[model samples]
Target chain A: MDLATAGLKTTDHDGIIRIDFIERNILDEANIQLIGEGLNHVVDAMDEPKLVICFENVEHLSSAALGVLITASNRVGSKGGQLRLSDINEQILEVFRITRLDQMFQIYDTSAEAMSAFS
Target chain B: MAESPGHHDERRDSDSSRSGVVVLHDVRTELDSLQRAVVDGIRHAGYDEASTFAVRLALEEAVANAFRHGNGEDPEKVVTVEFKISDEKVWIAVEDEGCGFDPDAVPDPTEEANLEIPSGRGIMLMRAYMTDVSIVAPGNRVEMVFRPAG
Candidate 1:
């Protein structure tokens, strides 16, 4: 099923939410703020949110976008949930590695792997 | 010449370097076009994919920092972006209208104790991706240079 919640295009995969960002470049500050708000709303609705965000469509993202993801990850952890990032291109993944966010977030090679890893 | 008020963009191509000066008062409408132009310049100058990504990411972080932190999101304030794209390297500068702050005071986001902090990573990202990054005194302006990987 497709979900229009927040700025995300998500699908339900056996209760695991597979998320894809609507924008190719997730850079704009205002847009990042909106995505963060949307994520908070989704996380609040779930008792233990298990989400897999695929970056197949994302070409460019700024540090602000990473901040939003970190905030959401903290919220999910507080609620005993899990979040996974997958399908990140090499260059974008380098951004994660540079900031050491790779250690904080679980990343997978594909969305399917990310979804399967969710418990 | 520096241009401000509404939006002004001046582009020039020469044997030395291709220069672009943009003064953006409305970030929402103007920022993306500027990025596109920069990417196009990099492509035209035959920069590799990695260099393109590095310059583009650093540019985004710098510009966003100027708009959000430096300009304080004031619509009346303008952010200025200046760039010189060359065959071997790319140089960019982003300036805001607000008074600058101390960059050293920005804690390292990668520190073990501060891993979960949601912000304060822009400067770090710029420094990581760019070959050289410097903030002009007063801290309102940042200049970065990225040389194609050899």
Candidate 2:
């Protein structure tokens, strides 16, 4: 089931799939839906079990967007697969800290580091 | 009987003394403008980047809760937002036209059993980012405050 997800950029690194998000800010319902649907596509298209979501440019992430991440994490976990994050801005990292999601998701300094985690 | 969208208004005091009120329909399209106005207002009030980010995050969460849970995404309903910036504090309030829930009853999202649950984290993030979070008007309205660093 291929869905239209213009908000995300996908790349294949070895066997790990890396999804770099282009949306710098995820605020309104439309953008939130974009992230949610984009992740759904990634999860569904996972011939490989490992995935890394990079927030290199996303400075503002609303709780709604966080909900999308949580849902994606759950979907990956259900398949005995892993989902991780990289390049999170410091300000946005505070949000993850406040919610303690930093503990739930493995976070790294770069996409390379996150990709290496799959090994 | 649905009221048309774009029927809302925004009012800023003539003095422009770092305070204003924005009344909006439950329309989702209006949120982007509201958030931009609030962010610009807070920045103009001399909040640093970190403080501004925290306040903005909390404000977005509160407003999203009103639109999503409070009004059940009913465009006919209304969501009223009020914000004030003082010398040392920034305050925001969001009220929805739906029957409110008990904030106390929301379980902690950080709990191991609840980590994967996505619904309850909005309230938790609001409380975490804001200096104070209070539910008023029978839980229909949420008020949050942020105290800036010196």
Candidate 3:
């Protein structure tokens, strides 16, 4: 996906799609909308898609960003696909833990770990 | 969960030497400058990364809540943002044009049943990040403060 259009770098490793955020801060309202749509497109493109959202480059994100992730996870799960999150920084991880999203999502430390976990 | 305990209604006498109040009709157009006004002041006051993250998240959520739920997504209605940044803490309050609701009536997003719901987590995150987060009643206005650990 185009970086500005999606704020993401999506690559296929075998059949698993690993998506990386190109923007350091994912807090803007307009950009977050683009990202939500882009992620939905990726999830809808494949049958039982296994996706990895790696936050290795993201420095900050607001609650709106988290909402998009939950939306993507729900959409993919309904289609029998799987989603994993990886490389989230401590600050962002705290946001997840506080909201108990850490319990709701499959979080891994690395992209490879997430891919492997996708059965 | 609800808010930081016990200190909800007590506003600080004076914690910071600098402050600003910004009123905007469309949050989409104003969020960047609004962010800079608050974040730059916090940085200038020498707060750490964690503090900055906490303040920024709370600020964004509060402003978005004012824009969306409070104003009902109407661009013509203004959102007023007031901020004070000091060496000890950053205090911000965002007020909307519409009538308010009870903050306590909002459901907890972290509960097992509500976990899958995407939208209700804004207030939860604000309460989590801010040292103190409270809604000034009639509920259209939220006041937040984040003090860096010593």
Name the top DockQ candidate. 1
The local distance difference test score of model 1 is 0.84
Per-residue lDDT over A22-66 for candidate 1, one digit per residue giving the tens place of the 0 to 100 score: 777754554777788878877888888998888998888888889
The TM-score measured for candidate 1 stands at 0.92
Candidate 1: residue A60 Cα off by (Å): 1.2
In model 1, how large is the Cα lDDT of residue B84?
Answer: 92
* Per-residue C-alpha lDDT of model 1 across residues B1-150, encoded as one tens digit per residue: 346464545465775457778888766677778888898888888888888888888888888889889999998788889999989889999999999989999998999888899889989988988999999999999999998767
Cα deviation at B115, candidate 1, in Å, is: 1.0
lDDT of each: 0.84, 0.79, 0.83
DockQ scores of all models, one per candidate? 0.71, 0.70, 0.68
Task: Tell me the tens digit of each residue's lDDT in model 3 across A1-119.
Answer: 55557877899999999998887875466578889988998999989989999999887887788889999999999999999999998988988999999999999999888888876
- Decide which is better by TM-score, 1 or 2: 1
lDDT of 3 by residue, B7-115 (tens): 1222233444468667766666678677866777788778887888888888888888898899999966778788888887788989988899888889998889999
Q: Kindly give the stretch of ten consecutive residues in candidate 3 chain A with the minimal lDDT sum.
A: A22-31
Off by over 4 Å in 3: A1-4, B1-16
Q: Sort by DockQ, best first: what order?
A: 1, 2, 3
iRMSD of all candidate structures: 1.4, 1.5, 1.1
Looking at candidate 2 chain A, the ten consecutive residues that score lowest on lDDT are A1-10
Candidate 1, pairs of clashing residues: none
Native contacts, share recovered per candidate: 0.70, 0.66, 0.68
Docking class of 1: medium
